[model samples]
Target: MKKRLDLAAFRDGILSGSRVVLGQAITLVESALDSDQELAAELIQSLMSHTGRAIRIGITGVPGVGKSTFIEAFGKMLLEKEKKVAVLAIDPSSQLTKGSILGDKTRMESLASDKRAFIRPSASGGTLGGVSGKTSEAMLLCEAAGFDVILVETVGVGQSETAVKNMVDYFLLLMLAGAGDELQGIKKGIMEMADALVIHKADGENLPSAKKAKASYQNALHLFPSSPKDWSPKVSLASSLSGLGLEETWREVLRYEYQMKESGFWESNRARQRINWLDEQIHYLLGQAFLRDSKVKQTMDHEMENVRTGILNPGTLAKKLVSLFLSTERPQ
Candidate 1:
């Protein structure tokens, strides 16, 4: 028989900064089981006052952009300054098997081993946003547990990458130097969303190219309008191998944060994020409920068959399906 988790004990343990209890709380919130979800909601509600204290940053880049390496070095630097850091690393999951590489723990060796840092690498689980489905809840849990800095790293920049950007206080796009392509594999949309861009691999041999890339990016950013925060996005150079530019990158983030707070953009941005999260969750839960309705499932399959055989048009079938679902659904 499974033993019940003591909610009060867990709450106190997390508030007291017990890593073990914090890990358990994170795991509880990440679970998709119905029973666990009730407890998770309770846990989050209990810890609500303790959250939103951490500086949240979302980092993303292409495969070879050295995101993990940079995060390792950057997280270590923060830890050295007596700040507790939490890394919510999102790994790509397999479409066929839903399996994940789950290698961030191994990739971020130094930070993973550091007592001041907590690293949780989650599978994307085929989520549309380029992040784990429960990342926001997990982040709240981490913040409640006393993490001063929370770094969210996405699987890679793609259509769904904006999901992470919407959730974080700052969105950082890392790029490789000398890609030669004018856009360097970064889409204009994603590039515009970045609060800052760091050209990685700015070491000995790559120094010249990194500097050139910085100049090009700076010019391109000039063509774009200032961010809603009223601050112009800055581009910098970084080298995980040489540790050059890391401090500068951190400084840029701090500076941007300071400006946002001074302009009241930070509070408004967080408020907007909360509304977005609520809307997204409502859609997800409604979809799940629709799928779980046996009557709706049967009606949908029947409608799909009619559409497949050309007996019914898609628009008519969709309307009929929605009516059926609404009729059959139980009121909450």
Candidate 2:
């Protein structure tokens, strides 16, 4: 029988640059099956100090916007430049089986084949943010394993993107020029998170359409004024399939980094994300603890039954839930 996956040896394998072990470690973190969550948590603590070196870029877009395809192209380019790229993709999985659509891996076949790139697809599994508890921790593990670029790809257009933007140094929004599409389709708050907007799949038959979309985006962007750094958001068109306009996109990312550093948004953003993360996790833990109380559980059941019977008002039900939360002394 195979020995249990050894944590100590696994840790050493990470430090020693063993890709096989690195893959296992990443899988452990991404798979939040109830049994592994605690072990993954412990491993992340051990790997904490080794993180933060990678340039974390988070990419998101609406469904069918080619996020996976763009990542494949972008990742391959980085690999050709001899950079080790690791992708932590957060996409919802089937609740029953807890596996992603697995489309990311399929789209990123080339990147997967590259020696310099590591791709891990994580099942969101009803996770609100589409990120598991160990995402940041896994990032640290990847950084420690010597990956130069750690890419956190999240499901687009909602809480998932918001969650990813909080953790990454740069947030990238990918757009496409479908028939008569408008910026109105994307929420303003999500657009505001973007450090840059890339018009993806800009090539051949799509080039002219992409250009028009780029102009429209530029016009829409003027409405946001400038970022806190006095930097106007950058917009560009790129063909992930044809490898066109990639270099400029990379340059813009670097420029954004420089502007952020110069204007102190770098540290400021990181600090804010830290506080936000702390608060979010605290609230989550508190809610979990509050619900775990036997009394609270019974109350919830009663409340739901009351709602079903039309005896309980929604507002009153919410109040009762909040009271339950408030009454509980949450453990730190």
Candidate 3:
């Protein structure tokens, strides 16, 4: 089994145009079991030695913003331009039953049929830490699979999809028209992270509303300092169903890419992502290792009870757990 899951052979398969193997590797990486997770991280480390090729994009939206439909249309448009696109969608709702109402493949029908595009649903397995911490590795596998563009669609919780944004070259946030809570849904902090915001369903009777929404977003965006990218975040209108403004949206994405590259922010940002990925993985594995301790397990069960009983503060309790954990370290 170890030989079968060997990272070197898997690396070769990805480089040799075997997308199936690449997909399987991502599945392994996204697994929740400890053994599988360790093997996955090992494989990803081997593959990371050959990195920095694909353009990673993270797309996030509030619920009902038509993200899946927009991805379908946008993917079709990318394939038209002869670009290979890979989409990894993280839907938190898959936690309970491992079920998705409209899984990425089913929702993005056209892209699913397109040979140049690959769409995979999140095998989140109840871990919301960006698909059990496999998202970054899966992205690397997608890049090795020769997809020039990768879109990571994050959970629509509107909380801190910040993890996805930190991994990608450009981040796109989608919004709807006449939502009444659009402004409230998109706080200044979240909007500031966006490279571009697209008002979806901008066709037929909704055109005017989309325009209004776009103007409002644009005005709101101007109030914040410019994004890390040299170009200011742009707001556009697009009808994913009618395919209106789809081309312009892609063009603006490319424009943002080029502008960032010209300003040297592109390379710097990617390097920063690499460092962050390393730090995050280290943090995750250490936490996992700490949890393996029997004392840690007992402490966890005890800490929650203490919190519930108001006998201990969360921060101080957490520090005690960590202190005990460090002091009780065994074999490395």
Candidate 4:
């Protein structure tokens, strides 16, 4: 038999700032087993008061924009300011084998080795928006562990940015300079959602182009409607290698936070996000229940074959499975 988890021990270790315990707690929440999930829920609920103190920031960009390196530099800057930082780097998982590279720790060796920084590379597991299903939970755990800042790095493969944006206080979009038509590289919707834009690799010969890109993006952002928070998104240049513009980026984040909080939008937005989280949980639980229903499981293979052979339409088979699943809950 497996050893049971000690919830109190885990909670105490996390509150006391034990990195090992924090990592284990995060792993518990990431587990798919029903037993582990129950424990994870209890752990999260118990630590609810400690969470939400950290500034949650979502960072996304085009591939090759150097997100991991940028995070290392940015995180190190925060550490210099006597702040604890947690990075949740979401890695793209393979569709065939479901394996992920999980190499952010390796790429961010300096930051990973820092005693004040926590780097977690989680597999996306085919989740839309390039974020793992348990990412928000992980963020909560990190916040509970007393991290002053939480940085969520998305897979940045043109997936929906809404998921990360909704969970974060600031949404940062990193862009590469001299990369073909800059405006055409990403969806305008993603741009509109950004709290700030940083043109990375703004050193050496790339400096000029980075500046030009910043100007172009600044102009484009002017056309979009102002955010409800009454804050304007700014575009700036940064270089992870030379450590340029890191402080400015941090200042921008603080400015946005200060402005939003002063206007009461910060608290209201977080409340709205919590409600959205509840809705997502409901849908997720309903899907899980539907899949686990004995009737649905027994007939699923037959229904799939029927649909494959064109004997039954997919919509009809779906409705039939839902009906069967629902009927099981009805009183006999």
Candidate 5:
């Protein structure tokens, strides 16, 4: 029999920046067990005072845009500056195997070995967005664990970008040279949400093309309405091979943080995110409670089959299920 995890020990270790305990804390939050969820909520409540100190940044790009490479270089640079970095890489789960491939430690060999950096790659698990549902929770845990910079890398499959954008302080879109915006398949709305656009793989012959792409994106960004933060979006070229644009990109991020903080937008944005998180959790918990009710689950298949066979209407089935769930003892 395994020893039960001590909540106090977890809390103390996290507040003291113990990576081992931090990993366990994240696992607790990600668990689907009722017991674990109860413990996770208590842990979050205790650690709430220690969170909100880190700079949360979401990094997304089109496939083949060298996202992992960029993060490797970028994270190493942050570590060089003595910043405590935590990367939550949201890996795209395979439809066939239902497992993640991109979050493997080999993808970020250098940064994974660093003492000041913590990297966690989580399977998206068919979540609506590229991010795992527990990403926000994990981020708060990281902050409580004393990480000052949190980098969230989305699956970059297009639809999940918006979900990641809402959770981060600054959103970065990585692009490749040559392909026009439309041809590249990036959604217009995603571009609008980005605080910066980084043209990746800008070494050797790609440098000129990267510069041209940078200019084009800068022009395109100018056409959009100004951001609420009063900070103009920036475009820069980056290359992991040559390490050309790491410094400038970090500088831009720092400048954006400074400007947003001065305008009070930083704190306001985080407050709004917390409210949004609350709403999301309510919806999720309600759905979970509905499905977990024994009465509902016992009738679910029958109701769905009725709807499928056209014997019952969808709306009628939903009402019946809701009523049945209400009759049960709901999870507290």
Candidate 6:
């Protein structure tokens, strides 16, 4: 086993922006061990005052939407403006093997090597939202490390977009022009959640179509109900290769931040997100406890087989398991 750091060591290392310690601290939080979790919680509590300063932006879209490329360009741009950036890229894990490529660092070579930027790629671990379960914690750690911008790049499939939206101050959806029926290429719900729609790869011969797609998206956005914050989502074309619209995209983010802060929605939204996080944690803890119960573990396979064979109802088995779990003796 790797030697564990005391709470003070973890806390001080993270606050002092020690990259090695920061990585180890993130690993500690992501660990499944009970001792590590206890320490991780203490570290987070100690650093609470230092977090929530960075602008959290989640970028996601369909496969091949150039998410990594866009983030690299955007991160580099932020660095140019003398801003510190941290990227939390979530990679999908294979269901059969439970292994992940964790290739974001490889994909974003330049940005990963930069001193002003930090990139941490995590495996989704079959999480439904294209994000790892510990992503929010990692974001807080990054914020505490003095990153001005936190970019969360999701797997861009299924419910990943919605999952990311809840944790971020801004949601950026990247789309490819001429991929299919412009509006039909992605779900309406995902589009509605975006604070900005970026038509990526808008360079060379694709610029015109990207521009056309921009207009289409702009019109479509107008038809949706107005946002509660009274801020309209902006659609723009960007090319990661030629650096088109990168600055404009940052400007929109800043403008949205200003407008939302002015209207008091920024803090309110973050408050709501915290509550949601609490609820999710409750559910996760309950589930973990249920699975770890000795009695439940002893009967789970039998009950599952019975259910598979239609000998027991799933709901009945679930209730039975819960009862067994709750009835199990606990050490007070």
Any idea what lDDT model 5 has?
0.83
Candidates by TM-score, descending order = 6, 1, 5, 4, 3, 2
Instruction: Kindly list the per-residue Cα lDDT of model 2 for residues 1-332, writing each as its tens digit.
Output: 55547667777888776678887877776664756666777776777787667888998877777777888888888887888999886654435323342543466787887777777766446555325445766777888888998888875335777788878998998888876456455777878889889988899898998898888889999998676667677789988878987888778878878888888888888889878877777776676667678767888887898888889898888788778767777567
Q: Which stretches of candidate 5 lie over 4 Å from their true place?
A: 91-103, 123-126, 129-131, 305-312, 330-332
lDDT of 2 at 63: 72
Q: Count the backbone clashes (under 3 Å) in each candidate.
A: 0, 0, 0, 0, 0, 1
Stretches of candidate 3 exceeding 4 Å from the true structure: 1-5, 33-35, 96-105, 130-132, 313-316, 329-332
Model 6 over residues 1-332: C-alpha lDDT tens digits?
Answer: 87888999888888888877888988888787889989888899899999999999999887778888899899999999999999885554434322222443377789878888888766446444323458888899988888899998876366666667888999998999995646566888988999999999999999999899889889999999998789899999999999999999999999999999999999999999988877777777787778778889889976788899999899998888988887888889
- TM-score-best of 1 and 3: 1
Question: Each prediction's Cα lDDT score?
Answer: 0.80, 0.76, 0.78, 0.82, 0.83, 0.83
Query: Runs in model 2 with CA error above 4 Å?
Result: 30-38, 92-101, 129-132, 307-310, 313-332
Flag clash pairs in model 3. Answer: none
lDDT tens per residue, model 3, 1-332: 54455777777888775767887888887666778777777777777766668888889887788888888889888998999999886654466424342443367776777778877777655445545357777888888778999989876464437778888998998888896756566666677788888989899999998898889888887888755455788899999879998999889988877888899999999889888877877787787767877887888887888888888898988898888888885865
State each model's C-alpha RMSD to the native: 2.5, 3.3, 2.7, 2.9, 2.6, 2.4
Q: Please provide, for model 5 over 238-331, each residue's C-alpha lDDT reduced to its tens digit, 9 standing for 90 to 100.
A: 9999998999999999998998899899999989988887777777778866777888998887678888989989898899899998888644
lDDT of 5 at 319: 91
Residues 26-101 of candidate 4: C-alpha lDDT, one tens digit per residue: 8887777888989989999999999999999999887778888899899999999999999985544434323222
Q: Cα miss at 198, model 2 (Å)?
A: 0.8
Q: Model 5, 21: alpha-carbon shift in Å?
A: 1.3
Q: Ranking under lDDT, best-scoring first?
A: 6, 5, 4, 1, 3, 2
Model 1: per-residue lDDT, tens digit, 134-246?
78888998899899999998763365467888789999989887766556576788888988989988899889988998999899999998755687888998888888888
Candidate 2 clashing pairs, residues 3+ apart or interchain: none
